[model samples]
Target: MLEHAFVDQDGLHDFVFGGDGLSSRYDCLVITSQRAVEAVGAVLARAPSAAARARVLAMPAYTVGPATAALLASVGFSNVLGAGDAGNGSVLADIIVADATRQGALRCIFFPGRVRKDVLPQKLRAAAAVECDERVVYESRGVEGADAALRAALDAAGGAAQRAAPRAARTWVVFFAPGGADAAAATVAGRRLPAAAIGPTSAEFLAARGVRAAAVAAKPDPASLLAAIAAADAHDV
Candidate 1:
């Protein structure tokens, strides 16, 4: 049985591809979220000609996880990388650096939400031969009431102690992105609820806000995230 309850999150937004056209010569495409893939598809639909769309599709696409890679495949991206093993942005950056080392001077175009962290770009730029262009495909609005939901969850967890629920002492906030963490950090300040980050980027963002995640799941699956949280809960006990 799942020991955790999800806090309510609101205000998800649709995004559009930011670039007017493929202005720069890029060797590969970097896409992180499935939403970004959808945005790119929208851009392709408006392309001047079929050849234009074909050109973008021909470039090797590096995705953060298998889900993103699969979406790229549906959109006609034949050459895909980082679909397996490299589960998070940091690891994907490492894979790109290694692959680029063999190919020499890689030019990368990144499609990400505007609320993203700089870890991926920073790592890519650190390699002297790699240049990354960020195209903000969408804007993400931080949802309010995450802190309030968390507080309510904590209160509920405490009440469950009368029934001796196994998770009474184990309250954690799961953050999928930096935007959510950024929005809720202030309101939840001083509460210090153990947080579980979906990936390294969220963990780093939470850490910078002085709220270090007690558990961080780098893998891009629900089972992996649950396992991370369970292990952390075990350690806390």
Candidate 2:
């Protein structure tokens, strides 16, 4: 079983749709997460003219993976490409580079959250050698502490004992982001528990705190997360 120790806090403010050195159209629009897609959608929905929406919809949208791509589709983006199975910035950068090479030099507009790795833009520039512009649409913040539900579950599970004997316990903590890893680490204190990470970056964060990830998901999606949990459980068995 997997337990969520942290909740997401929306850090979106100061919306800038156009202007400020941003172009209305680009060769590609990159969205790193579902939150970024939603943030961009909110800005586009407030456009004064229908043509503005249409222009954005017509642009080629690239995402970290299926989840973000699905969110982009829901927001009326016509063409969306997912970064295959691995939902990481590096993988997405590769795909973007390949596309740009096939179509010649391209301009890219990135809608990324505040707490994002510089890997995407850096890799895109180096690989594709294109002009990339980043617009900070939203920010991701971690909850200060564990919620009531998580606290109650930890109390019921006998805290340290449950973590000490992973083979006898099926409960595991899943971290989806670095912020979540930090918050969960503070909440759990020094109790060693089986942990799973959504990607390599999150896994590294947890590893820094002395919590070795039992499994790391290939992509940051529900199905991939479940697969990671299953792999962790297999080790217990």
Candidate 3:
């Protein structure tokens, strides 16, 4: 099983956009992560007037997961829509596309991190009925001293680097996104530590780094990812 040994916290180093044109031009907004929600909340906190805050909050918000939707509600978003079963960028895109087509909504503003998958925006751009205005509200950087932390975590977790680790005592690192691949690979340099990717893009990313993922989740959700890992474990057994 994989834990903090292969990854670490993604800290939001900067918050970029304040709620500028969001209230007037866009009928709906797209938000992907909890960090993006926090960025929006910060902007709303600094809004000049209640009217400005209300205007921004009144617009319907489409988000990646239920957690994000709940955060939107807490931050005064009146209409919050979320990806129903799958919490990923692609599913969020589908939800946006369907809603845009049904409601005849045109202008959309996406509040996302600097390092995110392009699928939602790309799909929105490709759709005929929608025009997405992407705004970078935040930038995230990997935590400093993460590589050392990963090594420490592995060392604490029964020495994955042990040369005589049993054949059955396989070690795997599960990557939730492609961003963590390089650092994780470097930490497990000489070990045959298998990997499980959250989706195809991450799996491909790992593959490019000369590490093949033993499991690739069909959808980017916890259940699917865990299921993929369980299936892989079964196959190897």
Candidate 4:
């Protein structure tokens, strides 16, 4: 069950990500997932729908992946902006900032997770009147199932054990959320796996454990995460 609300918007764009793509659509795209196609639909269906959410769906849908675009089409959002794998907020901010700088209208609605950090929005808002409304569509809390041993195993293998096993190599562990990241960091010492964080705050929390970290995913969005991973991979290679 979820408690949803409809917040009004003033010339803002909605942005969110989950699954493999976007579940919703928007005029100016900033997302990363297939399920984000229904973003506008999901947001509009909430209590007090925003005018931006309603109008953008009717115009064009811009998203980060094919599945999201397809989903948007299935749900009736006609126009879309597809940035493919580059659907993270940083990339989205780049696009939005470019256009906003040109046209001089800087306003956007951010549909983010319950625990999202606001790096991209802050950058964009500095250039324009950014109106962000975060909706807690879902929450990903730390899984209580993880114990000390399991945490050690996960960290040792760099997130997914099987994937990291084959290389017989070192991999970086990226804790996606702050709480879970902190939990994982608390019980460890002399951890071999190099750790990274999805955002600076998570890095700060994890840093208390003597774990050095690099902050990626400036917006706590998957696109940023993926990009950071790719960048790290490149550096590793």
Q: Pick the candidate with the highest TM-score.
A: 2
List, residue by residue over 1-237, the lDDT tens digit for candidate 3.
122221111221122223364556677888877677887787677666787778788888888656667788999999888644545778778878887899886788887766577788999999988999876766655677888888777665546446544645566677876667655766755555567887776676677777788898776667888888888878783
Q: What would the TM-scores of all predictions be? A: 0.78, 0.81, 0.74, 0.52
Candidate 4, after superposition: displacement of residue 27 in Å? 6.6
Q: What is the C-alpha RMSD of each candidate to the true structure, in Å?
A: 6.5, 4.9, 5.7, 8.5
What is candidate 4's lDDT per residue for 1-237, written digit by digit as tens? 122233332112233332212234322534333333343455545423344444545654345444556666666666656445433546656666676667656445455444444666676667653333334344444555556566657555655545654555456677765555655675554665566676566676677667767536554555677777667666763
Q: Model 4 residue 51 lDDT?
A: 49
Question: Per-residue lDDT for 1-237 in model 1, tens only?
Answer: 012211111111111222433534678889998777877776677666777677778888999877778899999999999987788888999999998998887999898876787778999999987999876666555345555676687667545545666555566678776766776665445664667887777787888887878888758656667888999988882
lDDT of each: 0.73, 0.70, 0.71, 0.52
Give the C-alpha lDDT of model 4.
Answer: 0.52
Candidate 4, run of 10 with poorest lDDT: 1-10
TM-score, structure 4 vs. true: 0.52
Q: Rank the candidates by TM-score, best first.
A: 2, 1, 3, 4
Q: Model 2 over residues 207-230: C-alpha lDDT tens digits?
A: 777778888988888789889889
Judged by lDDT, which candidate is best? 1
